[model samples]
Target: MKKQNIVIGVAPTKRSFLSMEEAKRQKEKFMAVIRGIHPDVVTLVDIDDICENGILFETEKITQVVEKFRRAKIDALFTPHCDFGEEQCAAGVAAAMKVPTLVWGARDERPNTDESRGRDTQCGMFACTKVMRRFGVQYSYIWNCETESEDFRNGFDSFIRVVSVIKAVKNLRIAKFGARPEPFMSVTANEGDLATKLGVTVVPISPNTVAARMDQLIGENSPRLQDYVADVKQRMDASGMKEEAVERAAAAKLAIQDLMEEKHCAAGAMECWSAVTVLGAPVCMALGELSDEGLPVSCETDVNGAVTMAMLQAVTLGKEACFLADLTIRHPQNDNAELLWHCGPFPYSLKDSSSVARLVQGQERFELKKGPITVCRFDDVDGKYYLFGGEGKGVDGPETNGTYVWFETNNWKMWEEKLMFGPYIHHVGGIYGNYKKVLREAARYLGMIFDDADEQGVYSL
Candidate 1:
């Protein structure tokens, strides 16, 4: 997971209106709240001891404080709600940092008193919004309602969104096992381009080196691999797959440890199709286990998919997730439906497969029979909002293209109608939930086209 340093910005209230003690207490309380959500250093701008209520919003004061926050390298800025006039200061600091800004406001609920406080607080938030608009900056908002009120749900939601924003700004490290052979255009990516645009560093390693490291796991010398293989086998046993597939899966599991260390990768994309298959080893099963273990593997050395999956893993904190999908037109009766198929080796736990393991005519050949799965991913169009979608649970269609994993969600509509740009893939896998916005922001920072603007238009994949 990517960790980031967050800087909380605060300014002293004007003394004529707020006593020094009261101002300190208010600032402290707000800072405490922020720390509870994300513990970090708080930078007090110390603009003034106290000001006339409107003075905090003064252009000069705002500019000075904003400059200080920028120098601090704040990932996100949180400040108390203020009148519309005072909002530009916060917006200016956010613009300077080019980071997401959120307004922290207390939502009182004491009947008449509550209404007044809420209105005042919301006004401050609206003021910041206007400043952001004026500067053409993007921002988010969070409100902390009275503890007793039911508004805690929304409060938590906003806070999580802030967390997502932070994750995106922080650079993610992606490991590439090796370059793909020619003819796989969809998967090749320019690492220099990725670093220049998204802040991601592509850690590359030779496939030959990974192979040499795996050899070390063959004997009784590698205790760590032995232990990991045993533990992985235990998990596979609990999965109830056949004995052969399970044992092969275990070996593959051990191999991942060898590869990650040898490659020095936080996440990996593998090309085991030729090597393992020719050697009569279960490469697909191992890749699936590696993905299930949180080191996502995009098959056929798909670099973009590796980056996309890594972004999702960072956002989801390495929970159950995979990118199992394909893009094709749905049938007339299934316009709302899209097929979720896997050409990679998937564990039996991900889907139910038949005992008869054989090569499908069109799909990639595999040793273990594939099964059903949940499918989800983000679809992006540059300079536009992204679409998040999923088709949950279903059997394979009777076609050489492989299995069908069904999913449906209104989240697609939300992406189309709401957020700008998102993460998506022509290839999909099953594991965790969609980190739609997280991937989008990462792509924005990397400056890569998340998806072709004319994807649905004339173009060859």
Candidate 2:
């Protein structure tokens, strides 16, 4: 995983009621905290000259700082108030940088009769925020005035998460194979709108092209195919599966891999059902393998689902894989739980080891790993994109063939209502963790409507 690059700026001013020595001390402390949080910090402007105002208040100085940040390709900016910060300078840097910005300050010292007593950074932060608003700059901030407090660390972490999502979305390119299956209009996406509004590009490839590639690989007796087959046999109970089915699935996986490499795509969505007619096996297991290997692939040509999966991958830095599943049926024993099942597209690593193993064709029958999971979807209504998600736990459930998980949310009825009445589909992406907060922050930064289903109720951002 690539580390997110961050640039730290300390805003100090001569007009601050505090002495130069106090400002320099606070600046060093802020730099220490920033250094502990991230490694790739860019000190765009020198803070050593405390005798002069350290803040870049002049337009020329702010422009020079912006140029430095742009050249370094920083992902986000952190502005800390050394003293009463230069509001104009902070806002100027934020507006010009055009990246996720965070503003914060140290707590004020108790006033004394001495001239060097007051820092008044809390007041400066407020003024800086107002100027940022006037300049139409969006930013995040630590509400607490203390720079070394736990609250500040948490807020800083959240800001990093937000930056990861923004960077991923801005640079994403989805490989779309074939089209949405017949009778599944819910998965249809406006590619033009996706590109124009969200900076997401879709590279279309035909199912026939993939099939042709698979046949060529088989004819050439590719070593990759042999390795993939060996891998499948090693990882799965393939005694029940047909030999031809196994070969076809492995060939399809290779073909998809080839196309992904050729197109330089980050994520993919495939026509799984249609490919079954051509490849002699469902592509679910192939997709699962790809997702497990760090590239998320969605079934039924779910473009938005692939995008959502990509977002999850970016936020988690591939530490977890997102499972693409349909909200199939309600759990028989648990009224508040629903069954999330797919043909066999869940990663093998997520399958329960104790479940009766059956690898028939490209489909594997097993229960998903039991733990906390988050269910989410990215969709649009009237050209406006939205992200919806909530937390749930993966619990023990009855097996009904294929990859399955019993997810119990706080309120199934409310979830159903949201899906039914909202611009969402039955297809959703699930990742193991409580990442609703991360997703919500990403949605806010991306300017997308976020519908969060929590215990209290559904709320929008």
Candidate 3:
């Protein structure tokens, strides 16, 4: 597991507590919860050494923590708000460093025996939140009333998971299987920029080298392939799909392993449609299976989706999530509900259906011969959220009433109108469900605009 270095700074002040000992107690409590959440990489800033206790006379104490963390090269700051002290100090540090900050309220929200016994206690912590706002800091707060309520408990769980993902992404290494083709513009990105900004390494390899590695992959009789086949069969049976579908699906899985090793990739995206069409096999289904197996093989070698999928994996921790689903109109009359589907197979877990997976052979994969699907995308620029998608059901006509765009920008509305006037590009999208926050942070670290509406689809460049 890659480590996430998160430094937590605590405020010192006797007012928040009756004595230095009480302040220590409060700090210990918060530290205990935070350490338990992500112990391996979490560091605590001793308020005693920084400010003499839990007292804040000047912003120097907070600044000191920021400087120390900067030296240690911390990824994020987590502050346990004891009153306003937590938010105030955290906001100050964040404003200075511009690092992500999270305000954590203790899991124990129970009132103290003497609520008014101490000055600037938990209530003071709450009051100090305004101080963070005063400093123009961006922070997330999670208040849990013990680990009893499902809501608070779940929220805390999600928060910790999200933090872990942030850490994981900052330390991840990805192999960019081949050089960017001249025709694929959106796929063009600076490798060094990805490392410096997103904390992710895009290791590039020659296509010939990838092909050699993939060619070495063993077939079905191999132990790993056998296990994969058996598992697929069992899942198919459970899913209640036809026997023929199961067999074809199993073959497709074997093909993925071959491709993975041939490409020498943990994940991949390839131009395999021509080969698949020649072999009369399901290329998209293979892509979907590789994706489900923690490796997302995108068609057209979409580097952006591969990056997005990696962040999603870190966020969902391998939950049922994929980054390609359209948010187009499902029906001409009902435009509110966006259609969510892919020309390729997405995991049934995300779709929550009992349908068996099957291979789509021939040029049918590119044909717009399907039911209504939704098109959706997420964008989070500097933590400000903006996501807009609509449902568009397929209709029998040359021109479609929907648009598939990459990023949402200032001219998105105009672009949508222009695309709507043209032939509907049979639904192109990724999974959509409040994912703006999930991908935006990743993009921020990568120094790419989260919402680039004028990018004009990748092919144009």
Measured against the true structure, the TM-scores of the candidates, in listed sequence, are: 0.64, 0.89, 0.59
Highest TM-score scorer: 2
Error of 2 at 271 (Å): 0.3
lDDT, candidate 1, 1-461, per-residue tens: 23323354554222223243433445555544444553332233434433433235445665666666666655555555522225655666567666655555555333235334223455556666777778877655555454233453344334344444345424556667666746666565666655665555777766666555455555445677657556655433323445444444455556665567565565666665654543235455566556656566677777666655555554544434455445443433433344455664443334444433332321222222233333334333333323243323343243433333444333333322222234444665444344443444434443434442212322222
* Each prediction's RMSD to truth: 7.5, 3.6, 8.7
By lDDT rank, best first, the candidates go: 2, 1, 3
Where model 1 places Cα greater than 4 Å from the true spot, the runs are 1-74, 82-85, 104-119, 133-137, 142-170, 181-183, 237-252, 258-264, 277-280, 326-335, 343-404, 409-425, 429-461
Displacement of the residue 454 alpha carbon in candidate 2, Å: 2.1
Number of the top candidate by lDDT? 2
How do the residues 1-461 of candidate 3 rate in per-residue lDDT, one tens digit apiece?
12234555543333433555655666665555555654554565654556664444355576776667677665556665444344445566768766556654444334546544433344655665677677766556655344235544455445544554566556655555455445656444455655665666655544454333333333224566457656755543324445444444455555555555554444454544434433334445555566666666555555444555555555554553454544354434333222334555454344323233333331112213233332333223333322223333333322222112122223434435533432222223444334444445444444444443333433321
Write candidate 2's Cα lDDT for 245-279 as tens digits: 78888888889888987998878999998767876
Task: Report the alpha-carbon TM-score of model 3 versus the true structure.
Answer: 0.59
Per-residue error (Å), model 1, residue 169: 6.9
- Model 2, residue 447: distance off in Å is 1.8
What lDDT does each candidate get? 0.48, 0.78, 0.47
